[model samples]
Target: MCLIFRIILTAWLISSSSLSMALSIDSLRGVEKRKPNVIIIMSDDQGWGDLSMNGNPNLQTPHIDRIAKNGARFSHFYVSPVCSPTRAELLTGRYHPRAGVYSTSEGGERINLDETTMADVFKEAGYATAAFGKWHNGMQYPYHPNARGFDEFYGFCSGHWGNYFNSLLEHNGQIVQGNGFIIDDLTDKALEFIDNNQNDPFFLYLPYNTPHSPMQVPDKEWASFKDKSLIKLADARTGEEDVVFTRAALALCENIDWNVGRIQNQLKKLKLDRETIVIYLSDNGPNSSRWNGGMKGKKGSTDEGGVKSPFVIQWPGTISSGLEIDQVSGAVDLLPTLADLSGINYSIPKALDGISLKPLLVESNQKWPDRMLFSHWNGKVSVRKGRYVLDDNSKLFDLTTDPEQRVDITSQKPELTKALSMAVVDWKAEVLKDIAIDNRPFPVGHPDYKYTQLPARDAVAHGTIKRSNKYPNSSYFTNWTKNGDYISWNVDVLSEGDYAVAVYYVCPADEIGSTMQLSFEADKLDFKIAKANASGMINQQYDRVERMESYEKDFKPLKAGVIHLKKGAGELILRTTALSKTNALDFRMMMLTRESP
Candidate 1:
């Protein structure tokens, strides 16, 4: 049967069953031995130390901690250094770039639709799958969760949502305005899904966008962090903005915990608690401000602090309670582990790089294979095997002995470093081979594009930009040179035709009210002005690249417009209102595609 037909038939079955008497718990137990429902909840930019169980005295994460206390807590779990890559690995059981997701926001990088996802595996095993919260994998129709094995999808498609309250969410394929706080609304939708599917096996993937940026929280929650004078010094020393850091971050975490508590309460109310598998983890490591479990490095770096995340699994009768495992775990291992646990029968593509951890969970004494875990964010790569870790800058460390990654053993352990370096090289070669055969580029115009000879930038040297507090200013145009902006085209076209020019950019939350303009100037043509309206963080400009036939008929010499430029030199001017240091922008991309006749 066709996949769409199967989906439609499943929906019909669900509807028919809903009209009849709701299936009781006992009835569900007898019907085909219902598999345990799986719920994977992930938080964005949450630190390792953010949980109360992880030695944080200020932050109370009772709901999140309950998972650890009730089930297994992985003491040495790791994920990719950043959000998108970690998410890619979590869904595909492979490295992020191999799954077609490289950086967080670079265009054209998406979770390949052809590749199987954890949701697809569960759906094939007769489970209803729903995804809510941040769906940053891709924003296009074909790449959306609903199209990629999810029955329902409700969330933002970007990496981070600016405002915590009254956020913009996409329900299925339509954009919907949400009420109350973003996390709370997502939790409500998740609970509803769980309650509706309490009788059957279901997969709920709730990846919350919280504690990320523009940290705004409810007043009551923010009040708790106001009097913590001890944390103030630490926050100040770290150069964290107090207004946005302490108040917003604390509130965001507290809110996330509250929503988690709500989900747990719903499971109990519906008596699906024991038959549900709950997995709680963070998308990546903390970004600064709040807690970090005292590891090294921050958000984007490949250090332990950036990649090491708290992992908790809870299934009352099925999983051992309060067990702490020191074995290394990663997000990539989730798909295979879930498939094995739920009795899903399907062959994973040979491209997958993760092993099933179900053996470790079921047979406590089962020995896990000693394998190397690789992480690459942007262009930096890090490979870890047992105790040793190797990075691009030739830095190596014994994480087993030095958890903080303070002691560099590169000079002392040459043999170990060489072995790890060789492993990394081999892994990179494999990745490149996959890239070549899979027909997937990192992202259009990404700095890591194939055949590009530019040297990779050092991850450590790129300092974090401070959060802008004021609106954007037009005067800042002087700082932004035209050459610095990113531009790319599929091919050089000799034909003079109109094309669509799209520019992706990001500005501070406070600069939402400000106006920005892009002026395109070329030879003997009227300048075109494209105005930008703040949507989330970025302002998008989609305008026509017009070529007047009156100026030049033949395609001999391309007539330059105000926006279009000559081969040697051309410029586009950006203008915005005068404001304080309240705005920051990253021109993600500028693309020119031939407009259809």
Candidate 2:
């Protein structure tokens, strides 16, 4: 009986040890497969309320809402007040100006190639990276996405694309013509990149340019909105003479939603659903259209409407479903968060003002550090910390209670306001210190935008107009006499295209011919002067004018301009530049928009 008992005990011990060994092996395999494929889908100028989930009664964004339902929705996500700056923050995990992008016009300001990027971190971690969409970073050779860390690049290099139906896109280094809608083309390229790189870990950035200016949409999408009564109502409220609720903008949103669904479905089809992480966000707040998530202000302003954006993330089997996090976050947080998730190790550049969000994602109860996030546009700066926000004008708000920023608490809390104001000033000083000057001479010398001597006078007067030798003889015409004066400036066009001559001038009077001019040298071109009758105008009586006339004349190929100057300096003589004598010409800012070759 004793021998038999010993034999049973020995067999039991052997089985237990074998089971332990097997469990350890499986644990190691799980760790090996833990790295996730990351996808960041960003929309251009899409407001927080534009999605169906955000309570927009007019627009439907089912696919975007899915990300919120399946994973987590960030109720308080912030971004720069404009596009390029927000993009810079997203890529470098730092303030926009620190990464060399202060505004959309700062295209020549390159994001230092040496700076560590979110894509660089993922690529270094063995993830194939691709950015498919509007890459408004720099279009110069060294600053393109390919030159950065992206393995494949497809999209426009400019801030906005003019035509969505047929647009000029840059594939890697080559500019290519894309068919169909721009949104679809971007999505198609993204899906192709995903399919090609499905076998390996990958990072995909899909930044869709939609719901922006030149608001347009395909006919089929527009048809869905034809029956809606809200469209007519909104038009009536705004006193809009033309279509107020643009079917194109609505269709664009729907198209973006469809693309989101396509990407999500692709992951499921590839069996990568459980291993992929997707993040959806907007580059900035919405432009003047649709719903702005009930927030105040719109694009270009430092208000909530300009900075607040919709942010959602989904990771099947990892993130909890239907979770809502109301913490404050910004585009600057993306880099560190992505790096943490992908297991990438690298120190960020000096003073990178972002905190990693991996702890928040993995542990719901984790507390974020009390840190400040900053944003700027057009010299306006805003700083937010916890529930408090400080703007340039010393306005303070407890965002926790007044998310709309309706009531200012500066007078009530003087000390707090002073501290916040100082913080912004210090931060701005740091950013300015980091701006590395572009010593390289301007390829197309300084632009020739008219500069007026006085606020009201509209007559070309004394001022030396400077330009790049690339376009020699291009001169700026400023302070021009508004009545019966013709001003002709010469431009050496480096390339031929459907060029539109645009001039920024002030028409303080509402009368017709308050500003009138004709471009005789190029072609017989005339354009009606629209009043820049913005609410915050210095002279409310007269409207500011920025006139643009289409010059449909064909020109010499390869050369700057067909009409050369006698001494390589062309004449920009002005005469009969009529305007209401009561309405003085303010300033003249000139630039040409190249349509096509």
Residue lDDT tens for model 1, 1-597: 699999999999999888664566548666666788999999999878777788776678999999988998987788988887888899999888778776565333468867888988888888999999987786544566776779998886666554456554568754457777778899999988998998888999999988766455666676676555434223232235344365456667888999999999999999999999999999777766445645666688787777888999988987888887877779999998888888778776646788887876767578777788887776677887876777667789887788767778899989988888888788778774554233322221111111110000100001232212221111011122222222221221222334344433444344333333433344222221233334332111100111111110000111112233232222333343332334434333233333322
| Tens-digit lDDT track of model 2 for 238-305 | 12322344445566788789889998899899998888999999888766544554456667777777
| Segments in model 1 whose C-alpha atoms lie over 4 Å from true places | 1-32, 231-244, 432-597
TM-score of each: 0.70, 0.71
**So what's the TM-score on candidate 2?**
0.71
> Against the unseen true structure, what C-alpha lDDT does each candidate score?
0.64, 0.65
